[model samples]
Target: MNATAALHLIQAPVALCLDDEINIDLSATDPDGDELVYELTTPLHGANDIDPTAITPPPFTTIVWETGYSETYPIDSEPLFK
Candidate 1:
């Protein structure tokens, strides 16, 4: 038998206000109960040149998955500017 791993977003952000800080929880499950690591990915064709650690503003990075994965996400919205 082949073991597979998959990730599902339990709770996702639907809407947000300007300059809002919200705490979100992302949960994933595996049938085999295998260890999993979470990482924020972008739509890059096939390039690994951009080192996530050396970024200035700090792009979405990887995180070691635990029981509970919760983080406060900040949303910046400028209605007037747009």
Candidate 2:
């Protein structure tokens, strides 16, 4: 799927605090194809809930940390294959 399509798959809250983590789920299928793979592209900085590589700023001292969670699963499809 394209970038626009990928964005649609992710459902993040509009108003999130600095420490809040967003969760997104992406699931796709190809009607006439097989071996579909789901790709989740996020900003390198915003991707990790608490990036150890990130240098905390002074203002971050008062901010609380939150974890973002997401999950994806095959909904309904034809010709169920194991």
Candidate 3:
């Protein structure tokens, strides 16, 4: 369920390990030739059933990671897509 994480799932170019940390490519393209800028942003998460107010505005909470996981790494490997 938590695919495309970190940089909306694209920020981290490589997977992270617990013992070793590495740099990831946070690069973005505009499709058209244009200047590029980078900035850090927070990830949001909530319940799927609670559809009410899911997109209703500002002051969103950041996502929390569990053990052996960050955002992009340690994803479920079942069913090919999970």
Candidate 4:
């Protein structure tokens, strides 16, 4: 029982216009049906650092577990709200 689970991008953004909400979905399943957590990712930064403890590789971003889907989310911007 050494099955490894993997995520597959099912849907992706395409030809989006300005002020359009972005929607993406990644699906995965564990052979043992264990709990899973998803996170949003950011681009890797300076020195191409990939170290987990480098203090510069950037911490894990937002956890998307149990998040609301099938809804249009407004662009989170300070300028837009002001």
Q: List the residue pairs that clash in candidate 4.
A: none
- Single out the weakest 10-residue window by summed lDDT for candidate 1: 73-82
For candidate 2, lDDT tens digit of each residue in 1-82?
4333222365667786664555555566555555666553332332245675667554433322234422222222233311
> Which candidate has the highest TM-score of all?
4
Query: What TM-score does candidate 2 reach?
Result: 0.28
For model 1, state the Cα shift of residue 44 in Å.
Answer: 3.2
Q: Candidate 4 residues 1-82, lDDT tens each?
A: 6678878756766587777665556679888888888654433433333665554445644433334421232235434421
- Residue 1 lDDT (model 2): 44
Give the higher-lDDT candidate: 1 or 2.
Answer: 1
User: What lDDT would candidate 3 get against the real structure?
Assistant: 0.51
- Which residue runs of candidate 4 sit more than 4 Å off their true CA positions? 40-43, 46-82
Which residue pairs come into collision in candidate 1? none
Name the better of 2 and 4 by TM-score.
4
Q: Write the per-residue lDDT of candidate 3 for residues 1-82, one digit (tens) a residue.
A: 3233233344553555654544445655554546666543435765457585556356667777677665445354443211
On lDDT, the candidate that comes out on top is: 4
Q: TM-score for all predictions?
A: 0.38, 0.28, 0.32, 0.40
> Of the candidates numbered 2 and 4, which has the greater lDDT value?
4
Candidate rank order under lDDT: 4, 1, 3, 2
Q: Write the per-residue lDDT of candidate 1 for residues 1-82, one digit (tens) a residue.
A: 6577765665657897777765566566777887777764333223345764443343555543344332322223344211
